[model samples]
Target: MTPPMTPVCAKPRRRRLAALTALAAVFAVLATACTGGGGTAAQDVQDSYKTLPKESGKPTDGGTATVALTPGLSPNYIYPYPPASANGTVIARGLMWRSLYRPSGEGDQIADTALSLAEAPAYSSDRKTVTIKMKDYSWSNGRPVTADDVVFSLDLLKAALKESPANWSFYTPGQFPDGVTAKATTPDTLTLELDTAYNPSYLLSMLTLLYVMPSEEWNIARTGGPHLDHSDPENAKAIYTYLTKQSESQSTFADNPLWQVVNGPYRLKSFDPTTGSFSLAPNKEYSGPGDSRLDQVDFKSFTSAAAVLNQFKAGKLTVGTLDSSFITQIDALKKQGYHVYGAPAPARFDPLVLNFENTTNNFDKVIARPYVRQALQHLIDQGGYVKSRGVYNGAASPNYSTAGSGSPYPPEFGDQAPYPYDPAAAEKLLTDNGWKVVPDGSTTCERPGTGPGECGAGIPQGQTIDFTLSSANTPAYVGARDIAFASQAKKLGVEVTIETKSLNYLYTNYGNSFAPANKDKWAAQDYGPLYLAAGYPSSNTVFNTGGSFNLGGYRNAEVDKLIEASTFGADPTVLSTEVTSLSKDLPVLFFPTPHTLVVWKDTLSGPPSSFNALLSFLYTPELWYFREQDS
Candidate 1:
């Protein structure tokens, strides 16, 4: 769900902590263990960016590059504002879309579409108004990208929020436009006035979410034809529905006028629905850096990792991510003229999230108990799961906090896990809590109470520990991990029914609050390896009470307070303490954090030497180019 670790929430203020000593040792061991077959060669490549082989002469003007897309991956919505946007859609949009600031190779912001937009925004004396200046760039249709376009995009977003409140996770309804307004001071300047001061880093990072669109192309009524009257409720809903429907229907990519207008380096030339393959031709009118060296670039999708690897071996693909299953084959690939780069650890962490609002079977009452959640964590063989998953080698480690172990947050915040792999400890915790343990059958609550050896209130006697465990069907590894976890859980007298669902279904129907009926159906879900945006490790959208991505509906007054403080207060000590508290609280059972592995042909150049695989690679496709041939 959420395109394999794509974060679903809005930006929140991040926490900071100093470097941790213990974490460094653990990472060393895990990294060594995970890179076993491929030896130090792969790890060396992974630790830093490996430069592409240099050409002897000047670069050639034009060629076509072939890249790989995950199978079954297609953009259902090319527009970025929609809540249902996927990785495929983001990649497709990146080719034609232009944001005010693009992430550099090191994940720092640089003005790409906007020339010298703002380093640190100029705030008013009251610190409530932010003014930004735009660059002189033009759309493919030769219209200057102006401050009106920026203001228009925000207006469209505001209307979209009214139509679908769940879609815009960044701004709170009524609170958004209450005092916040965008004004075009000049054709090249747009000023944002806020009623209250917000965290500067959080506010600036949120700008990346805005993808400027030609108001002329999108803000039109179904029948009125080319009108920007979003102020009218009827017109706003109609325009949103029209653009959304057009994006969903991709029978012919080139024929759609809505998809033709662009500002980025590439334009869509062909799309094959049957194979999920598409080709993009360079935009001659593009104003960004690294002007297209390739005449056309084709993205090929394969049903399985094996299919992708096959193409790589045949030299059909110029660049592609090497799945964990193919890690051991790096040596062979190297001999075949392929350069492997250790993908930076993705910003995601796989966790088993228990629903706290399941009233259907009275299971919520049991899950509400802190001891029950803790025991479930102890019962999971996290180390074993990581080893058996066969992806990322043993590089994956047991994580407990919402912030990933590899995240920028200090390691000490997540260094200590409240629950480790100890079934005996698990059984003891349950037994001490009034759960009648039956090794192979089911554990039932024997004593309900507020005293020792008693279950929490509302949990009736004889309520068995049985619930369905749902996970994603693809990746093959997640299913394996779920099966193993269920088997291990059985040893603790826990009854788990495993159900595998598609990624989209898991995220939309089960994980998202928008799908209440489906959300109520599951007890525990293990699909997402949820991620946060680079440089921002805020869990406001995922863990805070009523968060859009708070799939489990967890509510803790203390956690809610801490989340609010971290966002508005921005105190590192408070943030560190909050993470430590969560580690002990065990809101969700966290699994190991896995490393991303990418391999490409030696002939390709221009990819950043180092970048966060999950967030950076796809967002900056224009930097990539083919190496000049040594003819």
Candidate 2:
């Protein structure tokens, strides 16, 4: 049986909203929320070009930096590939094991060549064969990271897929690592032969997720056993089984010798099981770029956003994130000697996932119509939400496309919303398409025909426009928007009942594919945000027909062709084309993209690029250091 699914919560800004404990301060933030973004209140989603000021005085070594992890997203597993229930692998994966390619912090680029394990790939004339040259990096055991290790990692990943696809959420059957075969041409080179040619950009994006493991020390099936040929399928399976079993024993994570073989800048030093907090020490054998001046790095976790705010107020944290709920405390934080910066996370979009497979009340047929989806999209007041005191409080950006706001691959429609929030337009579109307009009352289909100005086929004449929207409970903005949407829908004679559920519960039981019995139980779900590959944000397994992650059973032949072209074809512009089509079609309802607000003490400093990585869900604590002797 397949295990329960766990959605990756990338953006910490929307992690959890604090209770309104301070009524006066909440109103103050709302008053200044409209500082900019006139007319539509749709502020530009582009990143701030202003670089953070460098720390004053000489840099000191051997100091500790206490970094705050996302609230409730504490790390529990040491393995690179974690199970669905794994809490915070995104933080652990990047810091413990380095991927083959480093995800670019910027939105336009696919990979960061400067920090990657391998140089840029050289494609063959036919574009089916590719060669990768490994950089000068070493494992914690003082062994050189070799091409054989990359191939060994691939073999084990294949074994994991054979055991269960749920082991890796990104794995879609027959795509990536399925038709691809790897061979170590030399100690410094690894070559891959692909069954079909793929767009170089798409291929690089996939490589960003492949974390390399130490083959020399990790090739055995059991502790102190003789090394086995990891290329062999059976031996690879045995080794994977051993490592996976070891990962489940969280108590031994810091003590296990297998877990300490690190290629990245840090190695596991200690772990707190009860609180899910962990500490890392600099790897003496780490051969990657950047200086490891800090003696230790600690990742602290919290149960609520209010707890995090209290820590910030007490000046207890060195570097951490400030939830938008505490935007009113910005001036206070600045007075307390902290720097605050924020922007929309790259390749991140907040969408209201619609269930086209839900056939309850003829919703399948009613939602199949283009005008209905467009009308529903108009009901989402993105601007109002950002400015509202109860919602984002202007710490968010208005996004209209899947490519996300301020994306390099913006649709032809650009920032201009194809379906802006217009109540009259929505009502007119419904009435023009043969639905009786009833403001604040029940609206039903009056004309039932497939022709123009008629409710499409399978929709009965008396069918009502009604559906239940299941919203995530923690992220206060999600519930706020759901209520606003339901109220807007009510004005148009549409009944949208709101139901709240935890994020974990929704991920486990709300999916149409996993819970077939509950297909008709939900019509829509707002799970906040979905993060894609850093730079190349392709919607292959998201909107494509029969996609593994296609929870709502959305199907469109044109979208399928467009996604294929972007995945296999060389032209990068095809991605914009695909997003343009989806924007007009409204595969999923779009919402405002939340800004990732990062807060840190003025004494703590690092390269400006280190702060940029926070937006992409990657951390570079190895380069961070204290500026003054007493910091």
Candidate 3:
């Protein structure tokens, strides 16, 4: 089966992605702003408080809203199909492009651009063939969006997968949407014939990731060459390569005729490469759900979260995420005439991932033991870490299941934490497993075998519990937590050495298979807080054996089975059982989910009331608008 097309916030191993900096100055100001009498106490305020002002009246048209983007991290790729970060994708695709469906605040999928273009999928009796009827929708260039456009986009994705497996997370090597064939049944209809029965929910969700492109404009013939047939492998690869090169060339974004055509609500108006800023104008021809109430939307990039907050304080930003370090500033932000609301807990989490590949100092022998992994989980001081890190209330809590607390899965699975903070429990687990523990010293394995009370196989006697814990050198808070964790582990005779590296280095050198030389260099890695993704939760990409993001090579046959079952849209009860089972397996040492804050000006209106805005904040910008000022 094809991997699900969902929004994933897994740690990327990119070379140039910038680290998020601390807003210490903002913290200092918040400390003072949140204290003193006659105001809402910082601790009393819930992080879930709605910050965006209520839509008191109908939305007023006109006026542009300025948004802030991380400086020096502007999106280089504007095409909707190619791979891009969530933030960049939101601005480049979510804002200017349209998909088949969008996520509702309530965490349900609702039709967006496809509300009129396509009908609910109809499946055959055998569930082998699914048919969709397409409606006539016009592109920005005045051309109709036809069935051919969808087929072309799918072919492009197939070709791009050949060139780069990293392009789509769901794409498996040597596979092409298994036994699937796209054919235009009529000018206004598209039929998808499948060779086997699959999960209709998953199949429909995947369509959201496949954005329709303009075949007439994106075709090879438009590049002054003969028309190339998508059916031909060589031709498809060539067209994909050409399109990819064009997408990578940031300078051509505004001038490219292939990019100018759009069927979405907004169109790119101007781009300032130097400032990493851009503007979007409403596509007058757009016939989607909501109208673009604003005359234009401007995105301004900032060097740091502090800068973004500064813009918010100065009334220069209409909408932006407030760093948690500045949580105490909520009262002050409100006093400054800004509407401060608590955002949902981030969908991502940072966990201490143990390397199971015995290649690293033979550390895998020790880490592979279930008791040892369990001990590490018990040693985590989740509460202290959150308090010290300034994560808001109800935001930080122990998480063990792969499905986040925010996922559609049942809460019982996510709420259960098999391992809680207990130094005694950690110590006993180590000692009972045949480890000679000396408090505040290094632990040495004394028994090595495949029996109860014996350290697992490949572990040699006298092997000390000592290894380095490396964390990404961004988000300043992660580094602090790493040190704290190492300090705590030391009390249990586990000598944890802390090392900080760039995010790119952590992903590429430590995580990805392409860099095997650096694989065994680090024993444990800190890639947490939270990793976000859309659709139903499945560990196929991150937890299954040999999965793409399975950085540490931690494999469990039971986990592999559960993940496979979950992908097929199996019974919720069975899926929940799988989640619960993994919760106790200690696949990775889970941590607390941090509370993310988003603040907007009182002047702006229409933010979604019940959505995973943290994962896809730019999902539907058309719904947002400015209110008319009172005389």
Residues 51-124 of candidate 1 have per-residue lDDT tens digits of 33342334556777788775434444456566544223443665687655553323233223332223346777
lDDT: which is higher, 1 or 2?
A: 2
Ranking by lDDT: 2, 1, 3
Ranking by TM-score: 2, 3, 1
TM-scores, all candidates, are 0.85, 0.90, 0.86
- CA lDDT, candidate 1, residue 407: 53
TM-score of 1: 0.85
Instruction: List candidate 3 segments past 4 Å from native.
Output: 1-44, 47-53, 70-73, 81-91, 108-117, 174-176, 343-350, 389-398, 411-414, 504-510, 513-517, 528-535, 569-573, 610-615
Against the true structure, candidate 3 has what lDDT? 0.63
Residue-wise C-alpha lDDT for candidate 2, range 406-506, written one tens digit per residue = 67788998889999988899999999999998999999999989899998999889889999898775555676677777778888999998776666556
What lDDT does each candidate get?
Answer: 0.63, 0.79, 0.63
- Residue 145 displacement in candidate 2 (angstroms): 1.0
Top candidate when judged by lDDT against the true structure: 2
Q: Write the per-residue lDDT of candidate 3 for residues 1-631, one digit (tens) a residue.
A: 1111122222333232232133243234224332232342235356435444456546788988887763224444576655522223223575555554543333333234343356677888776777877666678888887888877777777776666666665554433364678887776678888765555655665565567777777778337787778767677788877876667666667777777788777888887755557888888877766678889888886655677778888888887777665666777888886776554443344567777874555688778888888898888767655555233333344556655556566435456567888889999998898888888887888887778898778888888888888776544455556666666788889888766664434544565433345767888887444343444444556777766566678788987777666655425345556557666787678776555566777777775452235333434567777776677
Residue runs of model 1 more than 4 Å from their true location after superposition: 1-58, 83-91, 103-120, 169-179, 229-235, 343-346, 389-392, 395-398, 411-414, 570-574, 607-617
- The C-alpha RMSD of each candidate to the native structure, in angstroms, is 7.7, 4.5, 5.1
Error of 2 at 23 (Å): 16
